[model samples]
Target: MNTPQKAIALGIGAALIQALMLIAFAWPAANTAPRDLPLAVTGPQAAMVTQKLNQAVPGGFEITRPADEAAARTAIADREVYGAIVTGDGAPRVLVASGASPAVAQQLSAMAQQLSGARPAAVEDVIAADADDPRGAAFGAMVLPLVMAGIAGGVLLSLLVPSVSGRLIGLVGFGVVGGLLSMAIIQGWMSIIPGPYPILAAVAGLVSFAVAGTIVGLATVIGQPGIGLGALTMLLIGNPFSAATTAPEMLPQPWGAIGQFLPPGAAASLLRSVAFFDGAAATQPLMILLAWAALALILLGVGFLTSRGRTPASATTVSAEPVPA
Candidate 1:
């Protein structure tokens, strides 16, 4: 083909790629299962219900049993989990927050059925929100801090750059400032959201720090590879694996299986929990975020230090003494 024709084809291909990505998010990832959704259960015999839930979902979700029925319901209302199971006398009830994503509600409801094996089941939406909220939306558990963190995370990771001499001190300071600022903005947004402020702040800090550290660390290692790596984690793997898109249960086997372990997947469920679950299940997310951030920082520090050591003291030498005047 002629050059002009080839150029036209390449342009078309590029457009097609962008279009596909857009469609991926816009469309329902139907047939996807919950990989590692965190769910709360309440029942007369809590132990039996919790065990049954775990067995029913398998790799799809993590199950938690609150101290009491009220607590489990409150957890769901707060968005601590995707949904909860209330087991009592006549029929089992699935408790979910209205503000949560509808897809999740449905999936959790199905899990209740699977566990019951045709036993009567009912659904109770404890923290029902107004109709204005989007359907199947994640819980207020995530709130503003998480939003801020997400924005900051995306920006920081997207801008990573590598250099032979190591990053400039000014750049490091700038990145830190930027990351913190992102955190602050998210903290501010938390007030407007339904969930409380502390949850937002904590979630935001974790997401922002981990993402930023990831960018910084990757750039220190491979320069250009940082961009691709960030994209792989944040865009490709992160979004799909995230519980934010659909409750893990609704997702088919493969997609749901791995979602919970991935960063975004874990963060989405955890953030929502803090916002909606009344902070019942904040520990797991916090631990994951801390681990990722620490690792990234350590790697970045080592890279910087090693790079400096590799530089010879004679790098700036001026021929010893100017050879003899």
Candidate 2:
């Protein structure tokens, strides 16, 4: 294509790309509402409360009738449910874990107020968020930066480190350094995440490695286009659909569940679990991250072998060629 035509095409493509990004970021936020958010109810009026809640929000909550208030609290603490409602003797009490999801907590509080009508229900934060990040703004803000760091690490390693072995070393180094640095900033400086330092740091590092390693491995096997694909997947789909700023159940149906399978989403969920719920409900997200890491290693090995097979034949052919007079 001529310069003018190419320029016009590029401009149009950029516009379209920008539009797509805006939609990816905005759609979820605009549409966020509890689809099947888990909530536990226990007491003599548990059945009545559940019925009222179902009528009030229709299908907003998935209400589980625990044996009693103690069981409901345990469910919330264990991360099995976002909140619980205790409706028995005196007044109704709502137990919420803001650290698990501030959005969900706020939603539950609002719902409780609505249910109580004239009298406000007692709302207790069973697991409160970090004091500095009561609303979870800082915690939510961390996802994009982590994702960008991982993408940059992988892209740089792929471009600068030619050998697969060198790239592997670089990926590991980046994960370690990046994780520590991120923890220092978010945990130490900003006080965004509250958890055991070592475990939190390890989680951060693993997440970084999972993202960077995936990118590097894909590039190694599929060439330049792989880097683009990796970045697009993490940034466009993973970051937006991660549900870091909101509960996963708040997001659109399949996408919410699908996001948990990706690096950004899994990392966010895992971080929250460790930071707030004392590792409750961490197994699934941990497994997802590990699976990605494993895939990266396997791809790197395959790539190394494939390149090794080509190198010897090319070298042999070059050595056998006769010199020109």
Candidate 3:
């Protein structure tokens, strides 16, 4: 295309990208509401309270009847539910885990007040978020920076490291350093996440490796376009759909579940589990992160083999060339 045409194309492309990004980031927040959010209810009025919730939200909650208040608390601690309601002769008690999701906790508190009508419900936090990030704003803000760091590491490795082995080394090195640095900032300095330093550092490193490795692996296999694809996936799709700022259940269906499978979403969930829930409900997210890291390794292996195959042919072509007299 000519210069003028190129300029016009670039402008249009930029506009389209901006529009897409706005939609991706804004749509979820705009439409945030509980969709099949888990809740446990127990006591004599459990059935009545469940019916009330159903009437109030209409498909908003998936209510489970625990044996009693103790069981309900267990469910919340295990991350099985966002909150629980215990109803009896006295005012009902609402149990919430703000560490799991501050938004959900707030919503539960409001719902309890509404249900109680004249009487105020007692709200208890089963797993409270760190005091430094009571509302989880700082915690939520950390996701983007970690994602950007991973993307940057992957892109730089692809551009600067020509060899597959070298790129692998770079990915590992970045994971270690980047993970430690991130933990130092978010945990040590900021105290946004409450957990042992080593464990949190390890989790941070895993996230970095999973994201960067996937990008590096793609670039190794498919060339430069892979880098763009990886970045777009992490930033546009993964970041927005991650549900890091709120609970996944608060997001629209299918997409909410879908986000949990992505690296950003998995990392966010895993971080919260380890930091506040004592590793409760961490299995799925941990597996997802490992799967991404493993995929990267497999792609790198393919790239290595492909490179090896070309090297012999290249050597043959060079050897067969006529030497200058």
Candidate maximizing TM-score: 3
lDDT of 3 by residue, 58-163 (tens): 9999999999888998898899999999999877899999999999999999999999989999999989999989999998989998899999999999999999
> Each prediction's Cα lDDT score?
0.60, 0.91, 0.92
Better of 2 and 3 by lDDT: 3
- Whichever of 2 and 3 has more TM-score, that candidate is 3
TM-score for every candidate vs. truth? 0.62, 0.95, 0.96
Of 1 and 2, the candidate ranking higher by TM-score: 2
Worst 10 residues of 3 by lDDT: 311-320
Q: Could you tell me the lDDT of residue 185 within candidate 2?
A: 87
